[model samples]
Target: MEPGTHDLRVLIGRQRLCDVLFEGLGAFMLLMSLFILAALFINLAIEGLARLQPDFFLDFPSRRAGQAGILSAWVGSVLVMLVTAAAALPVGVAAGIWLEEYAPKNWLTDVVEINVTNLAGVPSIIYGLLALGLLVHQFRLGESILTAGLTLGMMILPVVIVSTREAIRAVPQTIREAAYGLGASRWRVTRDHVLPYSVAGILTGVIIGLSRAIGETAPIITIGALTFIAFLPPAPVSAVPPFINFEWLSSPFTVLPIQMFNWISRPDPAFQSNAAAAGLVLVILTLFMNAMAIWLRYRARKRIKW
Candidate 1:
């Protein structure tokens, strides 16, 4: 062979080796992820299985520990999760849409972009501190469900915004141009064409953000969420003469992570078991959110015409 051709063959052989090595590394990481997931499921099941009695779901936390169920924590978690989603979704989606579609490429937008990226990396504990300062101290909101929800909403805001932007950006430019060509206004193009196409991605991001918010304990704790609550939260609206009340905003609530933390801190062996059970519940909740997001994405892909 010519000398030039021989050198080229040698370089090509080296490149092929590097590619094979990278592929193997990728496969190894995937297998490791699966193994870790399986191990976690096994460990959680073993710890929580014997404690998964029906009463575990129905009963409230007890001093006896063994008799304690996760009722209050479960309800509180659900309420907080719902409230946080309510507060975060609209704001996050709007901010995302504006940044991705409407915001001019200026220094202000660049600054906003940088701040959002920085916010995503900020610790949950830092958000808790912010909530403490802003909600509890400044606003005098006290330790309440609304305060906790708002704090979590802020904590997850960056995630939701970034996810939403990515989702909107994923929609093909051709569709938007087509809508505009058909005499649609920018708002109409976004609302009728782009938004519908990106709904699944947005929902997936929302669900993932919610999962993170629900599992977080630090911000709520900083905002003075109680470790224990004996009573159910009052309804946000009442059927009585006045009809509406924000009294639910004033009541104490116990989230699952807070309850789990409290349980794990107890010296009793039974509390450890309860903590394990709570952890199992939390894992299940996260998994359910992820599964729903996956299903939504799958359906969205199936519905796409091209």
Candidate 2:
């Protein structure tokens, strides 16, 4: 071979070798991440599995020497999770839709966008402090379930907003154009075409956001979510003669994280075991939400035509 061709062949071989090295490094990193995750799951299971029992889900916390279960905390966590979803979903989705579909390209929108990006990076504890001031002190909501839910709603709003916008943006522009071609108004196109297409994405984002909100303790604690509540929240709503009431809104609630914190802080070995059990429950709840989000996304992908 000519000398020039020989050098070119050598260069190509060196490039291929470099590519192989980089690919191997990437694979190694990916494997490392999986290993870490598996180890964590194993550790959590080892610590918590022994305490898992039906009674753990059926009894309420007791300060009276030996009779304790997490029933009230479980109920409180459910109420808080539901309330957080109720408050965050509509507002976050609306904000996202407006930003992605309607907001003018202006400095004001730019500023709002920047602030939202920053807010997502803000520490959870900062949101907790904000909740303490705004909900507990100013609003006098007094560590109630509503206060905790609202605080978490605010904490996760940026995440929901960002995810919803991405979902909305992913809808094909051709669909919107087709709607308009049919003489549909902008509102009609959004309501009928865009919104339906984006529903799965929106639901997935909402579920993931709620999962994070459900696991959070800082913001709720800041809003004074109780460490223990003896009572289950009143059924979501009531319809007695001449009155409609949401008693859950006014009730004090305890969540798994708060209960775990209380248990883990105690001197008793049994309480430590209880904390591990509560941790296990929290992990299961988060995993269930994640699975649902994955299922929704899979369905959405299956339904997409293009």
For model 1, residues 1-306, the per-residue Cα lDDT tens digits are: 556988999999999999999999999999999999989988878888788898998888889887998888888888888779999999999999989989998999999899899999999999899989988899998888888888889888898898889888889899998889999998999899888888888999899999888899878777777556767888767878688777776778898999899988988887888898999999999999989988988888788865
Q: Report the Cα lDDT for candidate 1.
A: 0.87
RMSD of 1: 3.6
**Per-model TM values vs. the true structure:** 0.88, 0.88
CA lDDT of each prediction against the hidden true structure = 0.87, 0.85
Candidate 1 off by > 4 Å: 1-30, 237-244
Clashing pairs in 2: none
